[model samples]
Target: MLAKRIIPCLDIKNNEVVKGINFEDLKSAGDPVALAKKYDDELADELMFLDITASSEKRKTILKLVEKISENIFIPFSVGGGVSEIEDIHNLLNSGADKVSINTAAVINPEIIDEAAKKFGSSTIVIAIDAKKVGDEYLVFTYGGKKNSGINAIQWAKEVYNRGAGEILLTSMDKDGTKSGYEINLTSMVVRSVKIPVIASGGARDAKDIEEVFVKADAGAALAASIFHYENSGIISIKKYLKSKGINVRL
Candidate 1:
């Protein structure tokens, strides 16, 4: 079996790494370049740099920041926020992003997914779904989880996969930054509903949380922010813990 990846998410705001609960109450984490280097040295499976406020600010991602980060880390880096057109994707990739994650843009113009996949290969396109639980099902949210898109999370996962996205970055808004645990039900739902790999995000407090998601939710990867960003658990330590728990992980 392929090893389950442990990814650290850097929520970049104003060119610095930040963390928050339920997507609010933000706190500064540290410099993005330093954090990226730390994770790289510790052997993180992958890294994600999300310009969390770009969409809300109505501007493009920080290309200079992306370039700086790319120069510091060798791991696969995925970038998102304010990515609407194919040109944006090209620019980000050229700026050193290995994959371009699209959330609001994908919801607004899904054809962009297919177009990007065709131009850059499906492996380079990841669709990020920020979801909040509502009634019996989860609803997709946009604009950094500030607005409900009314699109069913499960359906949207399948839609994006069918549209040629190679992966799904599923973030549970309710579980985000709470560190209670992953929303296993939601993660599993999306995992089983789609053929593409699903990277589970939000509510990761420690190694056990990562283990649970991989074991129960069968997530392809577990993405965390506060824990890794604040040094609650380093990537190597988390991987060792998962390996001890019988999970397939690189150590």
Candidate 2:
């Protein structure tokens, strides 16, 4: 079996890393390049850089900044936010992104997933789904979690997989930045509904939270921001903890 991955997310805004609770009232976390190097040195499985406001602000991702951060990290890097066209994905990959994640564009035109995957190969495409619980149903949200797409989250997951997306970056808006834990039920539901690997995001406070998601929801990866950004924990230490718990993680 492939070892589970621990990915540290860098939410970028104004070319700087930032973090916010429930995607509101954001604050600076640090420099994206510096943090990328730090996580690389600490043996993080992968790094995800998201231009948190790019879609909402109606701009493309900062390619110059993405290239700069990409230079500092040796591990596989994923870039997302404000990605709308095939050209955008191509440019991000040229800027050194190993994978390009699309959320808003995929929802606005579902055909983009089929087109992108066909052109770029499935492993190069990642579908990011930002979901919120509404009236006993998990609905997809877009534009940096500011608008509800009114699409069922589980159904969307299966659609993306069928459309050839290689993986799903599933984030629960209700649990985002709360640091309480992952939304296990939601994660498990999506995991069961799709064949592609699911990377659980949003509400990871510590190793135990990550372990819970991996064990209970069968997530392929756990992505967190606050815990790693604030130095509350280190990637190596967390991998050590997971290893002690018999969770296979690259050290």
In the order shown, the candidates' Cα RMSDs to the true structure are: 3.8, 3.9
Candidate 1 residues lying further than 4 Å off, grouped into runs, are: 20-29, 53-61, 230-232
**In model 2, which runs have C-alpha deviations exceeding 4 angstroms?**
20-29, 53-61, 230-232
Worst 10 residues of 2 by lDDT: 20-29
- lDDT by residue for model 2 (35-147), tens: 77777888889999888664444344477877787777778999987888999899888888999999999999999999999999999999999999999999999988999
Q: Give the TM-score of each candidate.
A: 0.91, 0.91
Q: CA lDDT, every prediction? A: 0.86, 0.87
Residue-level lDDT of model 1, residues 107-226, one tens digit each, is: 999999999999999999999999999998999999889889999999999999998999999999999878799999999999999898999998888898989999999999989876
Best by lDDT: 2
Error of 2 at 66 (Å): 2.4
